[model samples]
Target: MNNGKPAPYDARVITHYGVLGLGFFPQVYYYWYKWLDGRYVGTAARTVVKKLLLDQFVLTPPLLVVFYVSMSVMERKTDLFEECRNKLLPTFKTSCIFWLPAQALNFLWVPPAARVIYVGTCAFAWVNILCWIKRQDY
Candidate 1:
Protein backbone atom coordinates (compact mmCIF):
# COMPACT_ATOMS: atom_id res chain seq x y z
CA MET A 1 0.00 0.00 0.00
CA ASN A 2 1.23 3.52 -0.74
CA ASN A 3 4.99 3.14 -1.20
CA GLY A 4 5.34 0.10 1.04
CA LYS A 5 3.82 1.98 3.93
CA PRO A 6 0.35 1.29 5.18
CA ALA A 7 -2.18 4.04 5.71
CA PRO A 8 -1.21 6.11 8.73
CA TYR A 9 -3.77 4.51 10.95
CA ASP A 10 -5.92 2.02 9.07
CA ALA A 11 -3.72 -0.97 9.62
CA ARG A 12 -3.01 -0.36 13.25
CA VAL A 13 -4.10 -3.88 13.93
CA ILE A 14 -1.68 -4.49 16.77
CA THR A 15 -2.86 -1.49 18.72
CA HIS A 16 -6.46 -2.42 18.09
CA TYR A 17 -6.00 -5.87 19.49
CA GLY A 18 -3.86 -4.53 22.28
CA VAL A 19 -6.64 -2.20 23.28
CA LEU A 20 -9.10 -5.01 23.50
CA GLY A 21 -6.69 -7.27 25.33
CA LEU A 22 -5.74 -4.61 27.79
CA GLY A 23 -9.35 -3.62 28.42
CA PHE A 24 -10.99 -6.89 29.35
CA PHE A 25 -8.84 -9.00 31.62
CA PRO A 26 -8.26 -6.40 34.28
CA GLN A 27 -11.97 -5.76 34.80
CA VAL A 28 -12.59 -9.44 34.95
CA TYR A 29 -9.99 -9.88 37.64
CA TYR A 30 -11.18 -6.90 39.62
CA TYR A 31 -14.72 -8.15 39.82
CA TRP A 32 -13.50 -11.55 40.80
CA TYR A 33 -11.60 -9.86 43.60
CA LYS A 34 -14.86 -8.24 44.71
CA TRP A 35 -16.68 -11.58 44.86
CA LEU A 36 -13.82 -12.90 46.94
CA ASP A 37 -13.16 -9.85 49.13
CA GLY A 38 -16.63 -8.53 49.91
CA ARG A 39 -16.40 -4.82 48.87
CA TYR A 40 -15.12 -1.82 50.84
CA VAL A 41 -17.29 0.83 52.50
CA GLY A 42 -17.25 4.29 54.12
CA THR A 43 -13.81 5.91 54.31
CA ALA A 44 -12.25 2.98 52.58
CA ALA A 45 -14.34 3.56 49.51
CA ARG A 46 -13.37 7.22 49.31
CA THR A 47 -9.72 6.32 49.67
CA VAL A 48 -9.85 3.84 46.81
CA VAL A 49 -11.38 6.48 44.54
CA LYS A 50 -8.67 8.94 45.41
CA LYS A 51 -5.92 6.49 44.60
CA LEU A 52 -7.27 5.17 41.31
CA LEU A 53 -8.48 8.39 39.73
CA LEU A 54 -5.96 10.73 41.22
CA ASP A 55 -2.81 8.73 41.84
CA GLN A 56 -3.02 5.87 39.38
CA PHE A 57 -4.48 7.97 36.58
CA VAL A 58 -1.82 10.60 37.02
CA LEU A 59 0.97 8.08 37.19
CA THR A 60 -0.09 5.84 34.36
CA PRO A 61 -1.24 8.19 31.58
CA PRO A 62 2.08 9.90 31.01
CA LEU A 63 3.90 6.61 30.82
CA LEU A 64 1.29 5.19 28.48
CA VAL A 65 1.12 8.35 26.38
CA VAL A 66 4.84 8.38 26.02
CA PHE A 67 4.75 4.79 24.96
CA TYR A 68 2.01 5.51 22.41
CA VAL A 69 3.78 8.58 21.00
CA SER A 70 7.12 6.88 20.79
CA MET A 71 5.66 4.02 18.85
CA SER A 72 4.01 6.41 16.43
CA VAL A 73 7.24 8.31 15.99
CA MET A 74 9.18 5.13 15.35
CA GLU A 75 6.74 4.26 12.61
CA ARG A 76 7.28 7.66 11.01
CA LYS A 77 3.74 8.71 11.66
CA THR A 78 1.71 10.38 14.35
CA ASP A 79 -2.01 10.84 14.52
CA LEU A 80 -3.01 11.54 18.08
CA PHE A 81 -6.66 11.86 17.25
CA GLU A 82 -6.72 8.59 15.37
CA GLU A 83 -5.00 6.74 18.16
CA CYS A 84 -7.43 8.19 20.65
CA ARG A 85 -10.37 7.21 18.49
CA ASN A 86 -9.13 3.68 18.04
CA LYS A 87 -8.54 3.34 21.74
CA LEU A 88 -11.82 4.84 22.91
CA LEU A 89 -13.95 1.75 22.92
CA PRO A 90 -11.41 -0.36 24.71
CA THR A 91 -10.79 2.38 27.21
CA PHE A 92 -14.48 2.87 27.89
CA LYS A 93 -15.11 -0.82 28.19
CA THR A 94 -12.14 -1.26 30.49
CA SER A 95 -13.48 1.39 32.79
CA CYS A 96 -17.01 0.13 32.73
CA ILE A 97 -16.45 -3.60 32.96
CA PHE A 98 -13.62 -3.68 35.46
CA TRP A 99 -12.98 -0.33 36.99
CA LEU A 100 -16.47 0.82 37.92
CA PRO A 101 -17.39 -2.35 39.73
CA ALA A 102 -13.97 -3.01 41.18
CA GLN A 103 -13.88 0.52 42.40
CA ALA A 104 -17.33 0.29 43.85
CA LEU A 105 -16.15 -2.65 45.87
CA ASN A 106 -12.91 -0.94 46.68
CA PHE A 107 -14.72 2.12 47.94
CA LEU A 108 -17.38 0.17 49.74
CA TRP A 109 -15.95 -3.17 50.89
CA VAL A 110 -12.39 -4.03 49.83
CA PRO A 111 -9.32 -3.09 51.80
CA PRO A 112 -6.53 -0.73 50.73
CA ALA A 113 -3.99 -3.48 50.23
CA ALA A 114 -6.27 -5.31 47.86
CA ARG A 115 -7.02 -2.11 46.00
CA VAL A 116 -3.36 -1.38 45.48
CA ILE A 117 -2.60 -4.89 44.35
CA TYR A 118 -5.53 -4.87 41.97
CA VAL A 119 -4.47 -1.60 40.38
CA GLY A 120 -0.84 -2.56 40.23
CA THR A 121 -1.38 -5.90 38.60
CA CYS A 122 -3.84 -4.48 36.11
CA ALA A 123 -1.32 -1.81 35.17
CA PHE A 124 0.88 -4.45 33.62
CA ALA A 125 -1.79 -5.19 31.09
CA TRP A 126 -1.94 -1.55 30.07
CA VAL A 127 1.82 -1.50 29.80
CA ASN A 128 1.67 -4.46 27.51
CA ILE A 129 -0.89 -2.60 25.44
CA LEU A 130 1.44 0.38 25.20
CA CYS A 131 4.20 -1.94 24.14
CA TRP A 132 1.98 -3.41 21.47
CA ILE A 133 1.05 0.04 20.27
CA LYS A 134 4.71 1.00 20.21
CA ARG A 135 5.94 -2.02 18.27
CA GLN A 136 3.48 -1.99 15.40
CA ASP A 137 4.84 -1.08 11.99
CA TYR A 138 1.60 0.04 10.41
Candidate 2:
Protein backbone atom coordinates (compact mmCIF):
# COMPACT_ATOMS: atom_id res chain seq x y z
CA MET A 1 0.00 0.00 0.00
CA ASN A 2 1.38 3.40 -0.97
CA ASN A 3 -0.71 5.36 1.52
CA GLY A 4 -0.85 8.07 -1.14
CA LYS A 5 2.16 9.87 0.27
CA PRO A 6 5.21 10.72 -1.77
CA ALA A 7 8.36 8.84 -0.93
CA PRO A 8 10.75 10.55 1.38
CA TYR A 9 13.51 12.50 -0.34
CA ASP A 10 16.45 10.26 -1.05
CA ALA A 11 19.67 11.67 -2.39
CA ARG A 12 20.44 8.60 -4.46
CA VAL A 13 17.07 8.71 -6.13
CA ILE A 14 17.37 12.42 -6.67
CA THR A 15 20.82 12.05 -8.07
CA HIS A 16 19.79 9.32 -10.45
CA TYR A 17 16.47 10.65 -11.64
CA GLY A 18 16.93 14.37 -11.25
CA VAL A 19 20.54 15.09 -11.88
CA LEU A 20 21.24 12.28 -14.26
CA GLY A 21 17.89 12.16 -15.96
CA LEU A 22 17.78 15.91 -16.52
CA GLY A 23 21.42 16.29 -17.44
CA PHE A 24 20.83 14.80 -20.85
CA PHE A 25 17.61 16.66 -21.51
CA PRO A 26 19.17 19.93 -22.59
CA GLN A 27 21.15 18.27 -25.35
CA VAL A 28 18.15 16.21 -26.33
CA TYR A 29 15.94 19.29 -26.52
CA TYR A 30 18.55 21.20 -28.46
CA TYR A 31 18.89 18.47 -31.00
CA TRP A 32 15.19 17.88 -31.17
CA TYR A 33 14.54 21.52 -31.94
CA LYS A 34 17.33 21.59 -34.44
CA TRP A 35 16.00 18.50 -36.12
CA LEU A 36 12.50 19.84 -36.27
CA ASP A 37 13.72 23.13 -37.67
CA GLY A 38 15.78 21.43 -40.31
CA ARG A 39 13.29 18.76 -41.30
CA TYR A 40 9.99 20.63 -41.26
CA VAL A 41 10.08 23.89 -43.09
CA GLY A 42 6.96 25.81 -44.12
CA THR A 43 3.94 27.10 -42.29
CA ALA A 44 4.26 27.47 -38.53
CA ALA A 45 1.08 25.42 -38.15
CA ARG A 46 2.50 22.54 -40.12
CA THR A 47 5.80 22.65 -38.25
CA VAL A 48 4.15 22.75 -34.85
CA VAL A 49 1.87 19.87 -35.74
CA LYS A 50 4.73 17.74 -37.01
CA LYS A 51 6.84 18.55 -33.99
CA LEU A 52 3.98 17.63 -31.66
CA LEU A 53 3.37 14.37 -33.46
CA LEU A 54 7.01 13.33 -33.37
CA ASP A 55 7.32 14.36 -29.75
CA GLN A 56 4.18 12.58 -28.60
CA PHE A 57 4.50 9.44 -30.70
CA VAL A 58 8.23 9.00 -31.09
CA LEU A 59 10.20 10.64 -28.27
CA THR A 60 7.81 10.06 -25.36
CA PRO A 61 7.45 6.29 -25.62
CA PRO A 62 11.16 5.49 -25.46
CA LEU A 63 11.67 8.04 -22.73
CA LEU A 64 8.99 6.40 -20.59
CA VAL A 65 10.60 3.02 -21.10
CA VAL A 66 13.94 4.42 -20.03
CA PHE A 67 12.35 6.03 -16.99
CA TYR A 68 10.70 2.82 -15.83
CA VAL A 69 13.68 0.64 -16.55
CA SER A 70 16.07 3.05 -14.89
CA MET A 71 13.86 3.36 -11.82
CA SER A 72 13.59 -0.41 -11.64
CA VAL A 73 17.36 -0.70 -11.82
CA MET A 74 17.88 1.99 -9.22
CA GLU A 75 15.43 0.25 -6.88
CA ARG A 76 17.01 -3.12 -7.54
CA LYS A 77 13.74 -4.69 -8.61
CA THR A 78 13.92 -8.32 -9.59
CA ASP A 79 11.86 -7.97 -12.71
CA LEU A 80 13.10 -4.94 -14.59
CA PHE A 81 10.03 -4.51 -16.76
CA GLU A 82 7.20 -5.32 -14.35
CA GLU A 83 6.52 -1.72 -13.44
CA CYS A 84 7.06 -0.67 -17.03
CA ARG A 85 4.45 -3.14 -18.26
CA ASN A 86 1.94 -1.92 -15.71
CA LYS A 87 2.66 1.78 -16.02
CA LEU A 88 3.85 2.54 -19.52
CA LEU A 89 0.47 2.98 -21.19
CA PRO A 90 -0.97 5.16 -18.48
CA THR A 91 2.17 7.23 -18.28
CA PHE A 92 2.35 7.71 -22.03
CA LYS A 93 -1.31 8.62 -22.18
CA THR A 94 -0.83 11.20 -19.49
CA SER A 95 2.28 12.45 -21.24
CA CYS A 96 0.35 12.96 -24.47
CA ILE A 97 -2.27 14.99 -22.65
CA PHE A 98 0.33 17.08 -20.93
CA TRP A 99 3.06 17.45 -23.54
CA LEU A 100 1.11 18.01 -26.74
CA PRO A 101 0.09 21.54 -25.86
CA ALA A 102 3.27 22.27 -23.99
CA GLN A 103 5.47 21.23 -26.90
CA ALA A 104 3.26 23.02 -29.36
CA LEU A 105 3.80 26.16 -27.38
CA ASN A 106 7.47 25.39 -27.24
CA PHE A 107 7.68 24.93 -30.98
CA LEU A 108 5.58 27.94 -31.75
CA TRP A 109 6.49 30.64 -29.26
CA VAL A 110 9.70 29.75 -27.49
CA PRO A 111 12.92 30.64 -29.26
CA PRO A 112 15.41 27.92 -30.17
CA ALA A 113 18.10 28.93 -27.71
CA ALA A 114 15.58 28.93 -24.87
CA ARG A 115 13.75 25.74 -25.68
CA VAL A 116 15.83 23.64 -23.30
CA ILE A 117 15.24 26.01 -20.42
CA TYR A 118 11.58 26.23 -21.27
CA VAL A 119 11.28 22.48 -21.26
CA GLY A 120 13.14 22.24 -17.98
CA THR A 121 10.62 24.60 -16.45
CA CYS A 122 7.74 22.59 -17.85
CA ALA A 123 9.48 19.46 -16.58
CA PHE A 124 9.28 20.67 -13.01
CA ALA A 125 5.53 20.24 -13.12
CA TRP A 126 5.71 17.20 -15.34
CA VAL A 127 8.09 15.53 -12.92
CA ASN A 128 5.57 15.88 -10.15
CA ILE A 129 2.95 14.27 -12.35
CA LEU A 130 5.37 11.48 -13.18
CA CYS A 131 6.16 10.91 -9.53
CA TRP A 132 2.48 10.65 -8.68
CA ILE A 133 1.93 8.24 -11.53
CA LYS A 134 4.98 6.21 -10.56
CA ARG A 135 3.70 5.90 -7.02
CA GLN A 136 0.32 4.59 -8.08
CA ASP A 137 -0.30 0.87 -8.48
CA TYR A 138 -2.32 1.19 -11.66
> 1-138 in candidate 1: lDDT tens per residue?
499876676557566545544665356445644543444224655556754564335433443444444455545565754564465445544445555555555556546457647565655655555455444443
* Model 1, position 3: C-alpha lDDT score: 100
Q: Which is the leading candidate under TM-score?
A: 2
Number of the predicted model whose lDDT against the real structure is largest = 2
lDDT of each: 0.51, 0.84
What's the CA error at residue 22 for candidate 2, in Å?
Answer: 2.9
Any runs in candidate 2 off by more than 4 Å, and if so which? 1-8
Q: Any idea what lDDT model 1 has?
A: 0.51
Estimate, for each residue in 82-119, the C-alpha lDDT of model 2 and write its tens digit.
Answer: 99999999999899899998988888888876777888
Looking at model 2, which ten-residue stretch has the lowest summed lDDT?
18-27
TM-score of each: 0.38, 0.86
